[model samples]
Target: MRDRRGQGAEPDAARPTERAPSVRSEGAPAPPERAEAVLPEGVEAPPAADLAALFLLLANSALFHLGEGPDAMGEAAPVDFAQAQFSIDLLRLLREKTEGHRSPEERRLLDGIL
Candidate 1:
């Protein structure tokens, strides 16, 4: 039978299948690339550019200052409404700046966080 391109099936079967190389061999676990690439001790990892992660971080910070969550250090600090307000304002600014650019999921997440 001829394919849509008018090529015979036998001719196509004789051609080698082209595919990208696999990163790992069969039955082998994936290499720990991220783990092996370590930085000097006490050095912080590079800042992430993920909008969702940033949003969650800001939300958590705000909640922590507002006494609704624990600090990054896991300590319960006194409530600071002013600081919380500032964080929330920052989130609002992000929403404004990212208007018409965010995916539906991102918009929904931001709205829910707000």
Candidate 2:
């Protein structure tokens, strides 16, 4: 390799090093905090963190399998009857299992999906 010293490249010892900000006082690594979420432009954020979100997520999966949702290429996925049925069944199970515990709006959202 050609000499890099003459090209203004610093030796490793001359470069300043940075300590990672997340270390603990005892020198063991600190537990990570939940990082802020970032999303691509035009993509919707995930649903609110609740049962409604679960319901919506499962419902979305069902729709995706049914070819009603976008694929990785942003086009509608091909129909997958078995997978679609499985997703629907999962949604139904969640609905039944959470019967009385669901909020009014959640019940309506799930019911609408079904």
Candidate 3:
């Protein structure tokens, strides 16, 4: 009698007839479809550290202006200013590092911003 696989196929003696381990047996669940995060035209996604720097800059600026006067808040004014400056500096550094490599579209975007 022929095996289940039919002609030329021999039953593997090492494998159980009922449930042989399959190399292709239903692999890990198919990867879920994901939508790419669409950034605005001409802009590339910033590195994590650069984004974090931007966040810190904005957050510090908000904190600084929320109060009436610099002296109104304790030591937060200067500290916030320093934090914001540092973040801005970091952002500038990142831009400088990538300056020459930007595409024409990127240059236009940066020009618009500046």
In candidate 1, how many Å is residue 78 off? 0.8
lDDT of 1 by residue, 5-42 (tens): 63656676687888967676788877666554488999
- Go through the candidates in order and give the C-alpha RMSD of each one to the true structure: 15.4, 10.0, 15.3
Tens digits of per-residue lDDT for model 3, 23-98: 5447666658766688999999865554334544544454555442375545434445555565456546656876
Let me know the TM-score candidate 2 reaches against the reference structure: 0.57
Q: Pick the candidate with the highest lDDT.
A: 1
- Residue 11, candidate 1: how far off, in angstroms? 75
Q: Using Cα atoms with residue i matched to residue i, what is each candidate's TM-score against the true structure? A: 0.55, 0.57, 0.29
Comparison by lDDT, 1 against 3, better one: 1
TM-score of 3: 0.29
Q: Judged by TM-score, which candidate is best?
A: 2
Stretches of candidate 2 off by over 4 Å are: 1-46
Predicted structure 1, TM vs. truth: 0.55
Per-candidate count of clashing residue pairs (backbone under 3 Å): 0, 0, 0
The whole-model C-alpha lDDT of candidate 2 against the native structure comes to 0.84
Task: Check candidate 1 and list the clashing pairs.
Answer: none
Q: Please give the distance, in angstroms, between residue 3's alpha carbon in candidate 1 and its true position after superposition.
A: 83
